[model samples]
Target: MLPNRSLSRKLKIQSLCSNHKQQSSLCASFSASFSSSSRCRGYDDTIPNLKIGKHTRVIFQGFTGKQATANAKESLEWGTNIVGGVKPGATGEHLGLPVLPSVRSAMEQLKPDATGIYVAAHQATAAIEEAIEAEVPLIVAVAEHLPLHDMMRIHSILSTQSKSRLVGANAPGIISAIGKCRIGFQPLPTFSPGHIGIVAKSGTLSYETVGSLTRAGLGQSLCIGMGGDVIAGTNFVDALKVFETDEDTEAIIIVGELGGTAEEEAAEWITEYKRRTKNPKPIAAVIGGFQAAPGRVMGHAGAWTGLGEGTSESKYRALENAGVTMVDHPAKFGSVMKDILAKSGSNFKKMEQSLAQQRRSFHSSSSPLRPQASRSTPLNTRQQRSLHLSVEQNATILKNYNINTSPEPDQLPKSTHFVGITVARSARSPCIIAAPTANPHQLPHRVRRYPFDYRSGPSQSAIKSALQHLQLDSAPVSSKAAIVKLINSLWTMYKEKEAITATVSLALSSENDDLIIYDSDLLFDDAAFKSCKRQQDIHSLRNLTLLAPTDLEAEAAGIMYIPLETPASLKKDGKEPRNLIGTLVNGAGLAMNTNDVLTLRLLKNPQSAYPPTTSANFLDTGGKATASTISTSFKLLLSDPRVSVVFVNIFGGLTLCDMIAEGIILAFKEVGVDKPVVVRLRGTNEEAGRRVLEQAKLPIRAFDEFEEAVREVGRLASGVEAKTGVTEEGDLDEVLV
Candidate 1:
């Protein structure tokens, strides 16, 4: 059920009015007008056909493999128009489909419109190149651990060609629910054919949102999982462009998370789009990681916010400034869209009834979401770690590259002014930010910035012009020369070292009028480690002490882990003790959502014994996790003394539930289960996974429902008995800003 209409109206009015503070009265008038008449026309007949449809012929690379065969079977069952498949060094048939020797051979014989690459990470580049050379229109790469250098090379190759549009190197691929076409491993039951279009960076989060929408009588027309890797083949803007002209898509939902400037770029495009289009579709966005700590990498490799522009707050403000409705959480997507449609006077009852019936029928079917073994093994974890250089190391590298560096901290004189130099991941070149402060961490209110080309370096005239505009009282000729040389040297070092981000803080000496580096931190590109010998040499200088012991263990075990509680948070000086629930989940997005939901629920129930509750750590046993990795993850979580209970949430796609269950059982036998375990398993091989756990009779409670599992975990953590009823659908209402 939807929230109260009055409350929804109040929230909508507040959001619309907040943006136009100067003209509140005018905004209110416009808001009233918008509610009554800004209805999105259901589907434009004139719009061209979508990129993927029912009649689109599809094929598979690595066709004879176990993963591809399983996925092909599911796609066929879901009514995907799969014509044939390609498997090098193999002939004949698999799954009643022809398996040719190569992509070109399949192209000549079958003329497939799309191809799904289920190949290993190391082989992904070659498979994609072959598909591109054959001019396949749509290519989906499902490998999660593709090396950064390989992706960079693929991007370069893609830029030179205009034929193929790659979906993901780490993506779940695309699914057209209305068309009954599935190219990737999306859970089929959660999707329904409707007028709403969905695009997101996280696959599991998309599934969760789609489930809510489906239950609320809303179905999606098209859904695209854009993958959460740092450098993806398709971005938010690319997906938005398709939705902009898509006739079947009446409304759009964007699920953006912290990381890159994709959300900012999408906001800029939407601003321009609204200016030109007469009737722009309403857009509601849910940006994840609102409570995420700074400098901490979330579940996704690309989810860390290193730059100010990549922060969740920054992305939200940008999207809101572009007039996009901001949803606080994914659970609210259905309600927000329903309200939007209601205001537009779109009839919701008939469509809702139809979708509800479709969902019921789909659920009643005997088809089970089963797990399939993947042909590819996990990639070496060493290549995934990014090398961070300390102050002394950064200074040495700068000097080695002929760049100027400040003297030691003890030898430096009193500072007059401070300047910050940084090259963000998305930045074209280095930027010099000037602020009036000694603290390097504080972001100044008003700072003058000089952005120059890294290739050309900083020019003397440009530096002088920028200095004259500085907010400081005076800029002497000597100070200007010192700043120029400093900027030039930093730019040279940044370019030569292949650094992803080079943050330098420098102080201007009052006596000598020279700029001396006070603190320096550098992070080099992971791709460079594999290709550049200099980077390999510099890799030896990495500060191993910076990483926690658990972090190093998780890396060795080939799983991602992050401790949620700091040492201070765990130290309950005089306050009520907090209980830590250790979590194990697959996929980066699901890991974040699990942590978020657990935190929110715990915060709401303050009367419980655990007044301040949190997770012990954030762990993601990658998409292709094996039973061994799962066992290792359990060992790591149990090793943390602060952890009170364990919660395992698995949404099987590439990672199978049966495999996860087997891993849990293995951990019980190998390490001895000491803590109470709560497991919520769903998707491929869910029934078998649950049966395995039940048969084992281990000290674990397995649940098929998400809310039930969460409730159980909370009950165990708080030492309180189980609750009877679940919260009403609309009761957990978050403010939609």
Candidate 2:
């Protein structure tokens, strides 16, 4: 019978790829070659029933652990061929199935088909490697809090191997209802063997969506939790590839969040899928946290510092532009996705599920904390009691968590595709709807504060108005410490809107020409302008002498953010790099000195948001700084008509002064590029690189004297020093601090 398992699997594979199949031509009959499998034909509106078969064998990577035990019991109850368990002390003992210490032993004995990983964050790598050694086709790792570097290493590992499939380091396992089975942590009762292929980044959000669909009489073809980490094993594109082949999956819904360029990448893939395939699955998606600001560290750690990829605004824009419909928040996932599916001409009926089904699916009477009865494994009476207690405890905890708890089926509104309950925000008007709510239950359909088409203000005029608002119209603002304080006060008192504000022409154009990006993520809005005036005294945390600041002058000029760290004077070396001249900075970006506070009180304050000459703005070059990047960045500031000079503060982490010197030499080669760049070089390779610059006759003051260098950048930027007529622009447009 066990050998028959392998034969059955082979036959099934042949049937799917056979020259003449009786049923739907998923890929075999309609395709010319096996190479055509990549085409993912017959993907629209078909939900393949998940086949639970004997050929499917799984290995639990984290056996004998509490969470692992729960999932293991569920897997066994679901009739999975769970042949081996990788438990520490329990190795060599039988836990119903053989408990092996390592994956090799299990593979030698049972030859499992897939792996369900439930390892600790730190142990994730070893567990995955063991699975690879065992030759498991698909590996789903459900370990959270793995470091970014480790995840990247894992990603590197997966990229090289062709047969090995990796799911996540911080994700729930994937469950294919219509095919073979593997689940990470989804509530099994909530899922039905249906037509939609669901892929999501969030575990809790995925659960909510699954429950909603099940209640709406719609089951899933498969539900995969793609992990909400910086780098997951599988991306949306990979999952979509699988759904494309499955005859059961008629539609594909992807759930993503702000942070990481993952969603944007997914958007490009979806667009290609549409253009290439005849009957592409209509994609519905939910983009989470559109209401939240970037750099705020909202949900997942990956969602926090997306390395400039996962901004909510950028992700939303990219997804929509690619023609993949998406929602604003995660809550309104079902409704928006249903709308998209309906539009795609899928005759999706909102058949209501029975109350008994809902109760069973939600495990309402069974108790969510309790694991279902398992015949494959045995448990002690105390362990059984602990499981029951843990269920109740967890249930109680989740109920109080302000989480979107499982709602009663009948109480759920008769909305399309089992959209989540629209909780009333306030007693006033109903919550406004976010446009483009199209992702499967993973995307939220909330009220968008600003309309996507809210291009009411003229783009150019807005820039001009913004410049004028900063008082950069005629002359640079004065550097009176008290007067600077007042302007800063005016900035602090203004109320700022909580939406993403746009920017201008030469605003970091080299990086992204599509939008002429702002210098950084921080940009104050009109509301911030209003709120600044109401404040009595703007707390002067630190005064910064910004050299050639084009972006910060208009954006931060007079507003405030909380937990604001004091700024430090950046010179050349040892200490962290702060603004020595016309550079922009965020709090965590720059290094600080113990004396930054003293300097903030002593410095001559500048009028606009730009810091005063006595204090330097702490704009760390955001890692390595080459000369062209500096020059381009400087020019970006210079184009703003507010910049008078540019100051370059580089600690030279991998970026040596010689390369910067070459970049400066390159800049000088180009006419009309004459910003005085004050060079601060520190660290290894500085001396040789400096000599190269001196030999090249690049007009750079390579300095070992850190403080002296700052003084120079400061003096020129202060506008009190003798004006160098080196600039061809007639008058100084920008000054780097």
- TM-score of each candidate? 0.74, 0.43
Query: Model 2 off-target regions past 4 Å?
Result: 1-55, 88-95, 305-310, 329-356, 359-737
Reference-based lDDT, each prediction: 0.67, 0.44
Worst 10 residues of 1 by lDDT: 373-382
Q: After aligning candidate 2 to the native by TM-score, how far in Å is the CA of 450 from where it should be?
A: 35
Expressed as tens digits, the lDDT of each residue in 1-737 for candidate 1 is 11232432343343223222222223233334223123222111112223688888999998878988888998899899999898887889888889999888888899988899988766778899788667677888877656554564455444433456788767778999889888888888677888788888888778767876886678888888788876777777777888988887888899888776678778877988999998888898877665454465666756765433345656767788888887654555776888888876666764463664433111111111111111111111111245766667878887775656664466544443445454322322344555455442343332334444333445444355445544333656676666666666666666666555555556566666666665666666654554334457777777678888878888777788876544344457754344678899897887876766666556433443344566667788987799999999999899877777899998787677899999999999887879899998866677889999999988898876565577677777766554344235312112212
lDDT, candidate 2, 97-201, per-residue tens: 779777777778777767788776667777886665455667778765564434433443333333456777667677866554655765555566667778887
| Clash counts for all predictions | 1, 74
